[model samples]
Target: MKIYTKKGDSGETSLFGGTRVPKSNERIEAYGTVDELNSFIGLAASYELSESGTKYLRKVQELLFTLGADLATPPSSQTRIDRISADDVSFLEDAIDTLEENLESLKNFVLPGGSQPGATLHIARTICRRAERATVKCANVDDISDNCIKFLNRLSDFLFVIARYENKHAGVREETWKGKQ
Candidate 1:
């Protein structure tokens, strides 16, 4: 099938249930950011990382797809899509706790750079924050599930911890930020 469905050429797109909205819609912004975050996660996964790090990232990518779908389908639509759930948020929290066990407690903020994968994870974390903000903005105009925002919030923390873990395993020291004297 040709991927070019010129239907969106008019600067509009269809939601999951065949509802059409402008590409600038808040739902589009939220899901687009989620898609961006997913791509960054995939990039981070391509770099050298522990087996567990790669595995968890894979899971995160899957969850991001679910979130994107949830954002794409409006509550008024009859389309059925799996949404971000409390369990999904819990999964991120659990992963954060596990990764943090191997990381030193943060006494100060750390700069966002390290091994290749670690740095990529940091980039993903920032994108996750943007996704969260976009999702919140979308919620202001639409009936967004609260768990969607919660998952993004916890996922940012998870990304932060995992980035530190990746740097630690790569033998890279984290540079803590010291405010100007």
Candidate 2:
């Protein structure tokens, strides 16, 4: 099928079950930002990552697709798909714990940079936060899944730790934030 479906030309788009709403709808914003996060994560993964890091990023990218799809679908729709669960949040926690083991204890906030991949991961982290906020707003007004917000929270933490890991793997030191006096 041709990719161009002029359906959204009127500033409205359909949710998963063909319920149309403004493109600016909270649901669209939520899922769209998740899609943005997925793209940046994929970018981070394209760098010289270790096999484990690569594998982990691949898993997260898949999860983001699921999240985006879930967000796109209205809760009342008949389309049944896996929504975010506590187990997904737990996986993120496990990853953060694993990666944190390799890094020094944090005494200060981190700068959003290091190796190229590390910097990109920071970008992804910020996007994840935006996506989380958007999802929260959506959840506030709609019957969305609560686990989606929880997953984004844990995933942001996971991204921060992985950024440190990427920096360490590249032999680049993390920059701790210091006030500009």
Candidate 3:
């Protein structure tokens, strides 16, 4: 099959429900950002990490495809939609808790740096935040599932916690942000 559908050359794209929207549609942005975040997660996962870290990130990447599907399908459509669930959000929270067990509590604001892998995870975290904001904006105009938003929120925290875990895993020191002199 040809990768280029050429149908989108008219500045429009089709959703899962076979409905067409502009390429600039908020829903497109929402799911596109999630797709972008998924790529970054893959990049971070490519780095050296613990077995559990690899497993968790792989899980997250898989779930993100579901999230992208959820965003791509409109509620009005009769298509069978993939919806985010409370369990998804809870998984992120549980992962955070598990990773935080070995991490020091924050005394000051943390800077996004440590080892190369940690920085990569920080980039993924920021992308996750942007995806969340895009999803929220999509919610304003469409019937986006609240669970999807909640999942994005928790995913960012999960990324943050994992980044910290990566730093500590590398025996790298976290640079706490100090006041600008």
| Candidate topping TM-score | 1
46-73 in candidate 3: lDDT tens per residue? 8998777899999999999999999998
Candidate 1 accuracy as lDDT: 0.93
Give me the overall lDDT of model 2. 0.91
Q: Report the poorest 10 consecutive residues by lDDT, candidate 2.
A: 172-181
lDDT digits (tens) for residues 56-174 of candidate 2: 89999999988988898877889898887888889899988888888899888998999989999999999999999999999989988768999999999999899889999999988
Candidate-wise lDDT, in order: 0.93, 0.91, 0.92
Please identify which of the two predictions, 1 or 3, would achieve the higher TM-score against the true structure: 1
Provide backbone clash counts, one per model.
0, 0, 0
- Sort the candidates on lDDT, descending order: 1, 3, 2
After superposition, which runs of candidate 3 have C-alpha atoms over 4 Å from their true positions? none
For all predictions, the C-alpha RMSD in Å is 0.8, 1.0, 1.0
Question: Which stretch of 10 consecutive residues in model 3 shows the poorest summed lDDT?
Answer: 74-83
TM-score of every prediction relative to native: 0.98, 0.96, 0.97
Per-residue accuracy of model 1 over 41-118 as CA lDDT, tens digit each: 999999889988988999999999999999898877788889889999999988988888888888999999999999
